[model samples]
Target: MNQAVGVVLLSHSEELASGAAELVAQIGAVNVPVAVAGGDAKGGLGTSYHRIQEALEAADRGVGLVVPPDLGSAVLMTRTVLEDHPHHDAVIVDAPFVEGAIAAAVAAAGGADLATVLASAEKARSVRKF
Candidate 1:
């Protein structure tokens, strides 16, 4: 089986990021590399570039990474980091934060490729909970 893709969640709140990662684990994605990049350097309610960079570096296992950002600024910070590190096999998938992270983890645990894993996360954007 192919190596599992990784997930990096960017959130303004550390608890939110950690909780989502915990959910991924609780759902049996123990093998998936799930990293959380939340809060700012001061640990306040803001995204941190350093945290995002560290998370991407730590989560990547030579396969790829699907990053889901919680807020608009989180996306901007992640984009800047991605631009600086073009060599990293990662992509910013515009998807629902928690839903996308869970989907990505499940797909990756099932041995899906980078593209397929990314697709799984992106598909969460259309999920209807009604």
Candidate 2:
């Protein structure tokens, strides 16, 4: 496993991604790469999809998790990205936004297996509210 796992936090809002980045930074000195795809407000999937692809490509060899603000968009993007990357080891999760991003960053930094990290994140979201 790589010593450092890159994380891409996909949010419509830069501030949300920034907040997640700040939280992840607090957890440890991990190189969690955050890319705010579309603006905070609800935008078309196309806008975020292209940016997400760009960010994912940038985080090569690193696991990725999508942290969208809303459920519909989150679900849609997760399905699209995962279906497109069926064989990828990147941890694409649809858990709560900030907490999921933080968990992913910690798991990535710890070199935790993508499956384990994703499962942990999914379970950990029990405490997260939206």
Question: Which pairs of residues collide in model 1?
Answer: none
Tens-digit lDDT string for candidate 1 (1-130): 5667989988999999999999999999998998999899899999888999999988988999999999888989998988987636799989999999999999999999999999999999999999
Every candidate's lDDT: 0.91, 0.60
TM for candidate 2 is: 0.69
User: Global lDDT for candidate 1?
Assistant: 0.91
Query: Which 10-residue span in candidate 2 carries the lowest summed lDDT?
Result: 38-47
Which residue runs does candidate 1 get wrong by more than 4 Å?
none
Please write out the lDDT profile of model 2 over residues 24-59, one tens digit for every residue: 888884555555554433553333655666666665
